[model samples]
Target: MNRLVQQMSSTPNRRRRPDPAAGEGSGAARGSNCKNITIMKLPRYGALSTRRDDVAMTTIRVHGWPVSTWTRTAAMTCIEKGAEYELVALDRFSPEHYALHPFGRMPVVEVGGLVLTETPAIACHLDECLGGPALQPEDLPTRTAMRRWMSICADYVFHDVVRAIPRGRPASAEELAVARTALERVESLVGDGPFLAGDGLTLADLFLAPQIANAREKAPEVLDGLGAIAAWAAGIEARESFRRTAYDPASV
Candidate 1:
């Protein structure tokens, strides 16, 4: 066994009392149950100065609701990078949330006391900090391509398909048609491989998964004609990260 796991196993388990100051329904509130805590020592990565020792580590705290697609993106990024994190459920309109995110976004990442907002920025920062399999391609052109897809997922696919599928409302025919066109565009961009950018998964896949998952749950027919997208979504959904972070409507 690795030294880290051994140390974790040997350490005495201690119950942590919930901080009353964390507010109701926060991650800290949920963690009030002593049994919920798991002690694992993880190595530090990304943005750490060389001056720090190799064994040094930092905590990653994610504040968001699981139902939010953007929040899922940030949480999945951490999972993909093999970093342990705490999910703190916060009301977006709450003053506490505004303090963390000026724009009142759902996901706000706090790592080692540093706060970061916006899905793309937070995901990219976590990817950099955790230093595992690279989420963003190393080459400039491929990286640019990946970023372009990310933008498309955010600007077009998400707005047209994802947002149009209301929680309890049946999708309108016009809405489905627009969503199909966006899905077709996504299909055309996919190469003959498992992921969107290429053979390996990238930030593009992470960006699209939550939105796609929402579509799959709400309007399966909208994705029927797009074979490439179906296949890509299948592989992405199979990922442990997706399974861990993807939203389940039944649970809501």
Candidate 2:
């Protein structure tokens, strides 16, 4: 989820500084090239099936922590798209994950026995597969707004959540300030809605929900102070889709 925000903020519209992890390229280069390089452009299932006649609806195995925002983001997408998948919980300190992903990242989606890394890629594929509620907005401005907020949630909220976790650590003053700013922006966008993209619930809502959940669980006070973002998050929690993908604390 932090990666998601970093990537989104690095895009053209946001015009923010390039994340070191995203590289030092210009926005255009970073956006297009980054997608091409980091993302493996697998052919759609139908395309593969038509060409080789061997494609089938194989189970998807998601490698991630149940409570992780990224994991829930991917899970919510799968559930929303009506796809069936299995979750393979991963340990951050595990040597076994070295071969699976060089960085040992979570929410790596394996479909039809082939692995696909990166949450953005997985989300895009799920949106393509599902298409009905259209997780991404079709209108240009709405699309841009949706992507922008998604990036903000990833960047500010999720990043703070990550930085706050430790044996003797809590969110710093700076981190709380950032969280407040993020909540402000979220309130501006959410504005008395049952979902992030207004009346229709979309991937944007799911993507942000888990991050908020993590914050609520670990630092309820922080979440409580931000009334609007808290309310928005509660609405998402009330949804059936979210409940199904709800994190299991004991297992995570």
Candidate 3:
């Protein structure tokens, strides 16, 4: 997983400081006691982080509805790793739902007092903790290729398929064209592989599966003739974690 850089920006204070107490002078002595008072406290979800002498088992708080595809992806990672976590379902899909994330989005994961917003980061952290049947490629080149395809899966495959949903049919002509171009690019990157990373299941497979599943259900015609992609999607969907976490409208 790519290490994210945390950047903090400063904003100028708009409020003016009140005049000092006439007798006490600046209220330094009076305000000193206020430091001891705890007004606002951090919200605790459940167990987070890894177990070590220095650190606690960080709580993986999933802040999204159970049915969302992104939430499913993150939850499936936790299941794959056998990591203990808590799911915090949020009703409002507004900016307030993602106060902890840099970009307001669902499925934000809070670990070791640090909030990770994207699915890839959260999945990577979980993979680190559990370390069984690791989801990432070991070599640098394969890892780079996986990350690139994973992004393609996110930005292209998922994007167009999701847009095709509300129409209650296959994607529009323009959307199909876009998906075709993206699929061709993805095929070139992943060429006739049983999985995106060649032989084994990795993050690329996990990320790509749901997008293909969505298209399969809503826009099967768009996916017709994509033999390799279809076979990979079938294998991923057959996994227990995927079956349990992925969206099923009938279950609702």
TM-scores for all candidates: the values are: 0.76, 0.72, 0.69
Ten-residue stretch with the least lDDT total in model 1: 22-31
Worst 10 residues of 2 by lDDT: 47-56
Superposed by TM-score, candidate 3 places the C-alpha of residue 103 at a distance from the truth, in angstroms, of 2.9
| Clash count for each candidate, listed in order shown | 0, 0, 7
Residue-wise C-alpha lDDT for candidate 2, range 1-252, written one tens digit per residue: 122333444666645563323112221131123233243334553232211112126666788877778888888887776776788978775786765677878778766434566665566555554323567655434444455556666666566554454323576677666665665555555555555653566557777788777766655666555666777777788876688887566564
The CA lDDT of each predicted structure is 0.67, 0.59, 0.57
Q: Give the C-alpha miss distance for residue 217 in model 2, angstroms.
A: 0.7
Q: Pick the candidate with the highest TM-score.
A: 1
- For model 3, residues 1-252, the per-residue Cα lDDT tens digits are 111000101223344443221111121112122122211223564333344321235555777766566777778877777665688877555666646654566687655554555666556655554445777666544554566666665666666565544444445678777666666555445445566664566777777776667656665677778776776677778888788775555664
Backbone clashes in model 1: 0
Candidate 3 clashes between residue pairs 3 or more apart in a chain or in different chains: 47-58, 47-59, 48-57, 48-58, 48-59, 49-57, 49-58
Instruction: Return the clash pairs for model 2, or none.
Output: none
lDDT of 2: 0.59
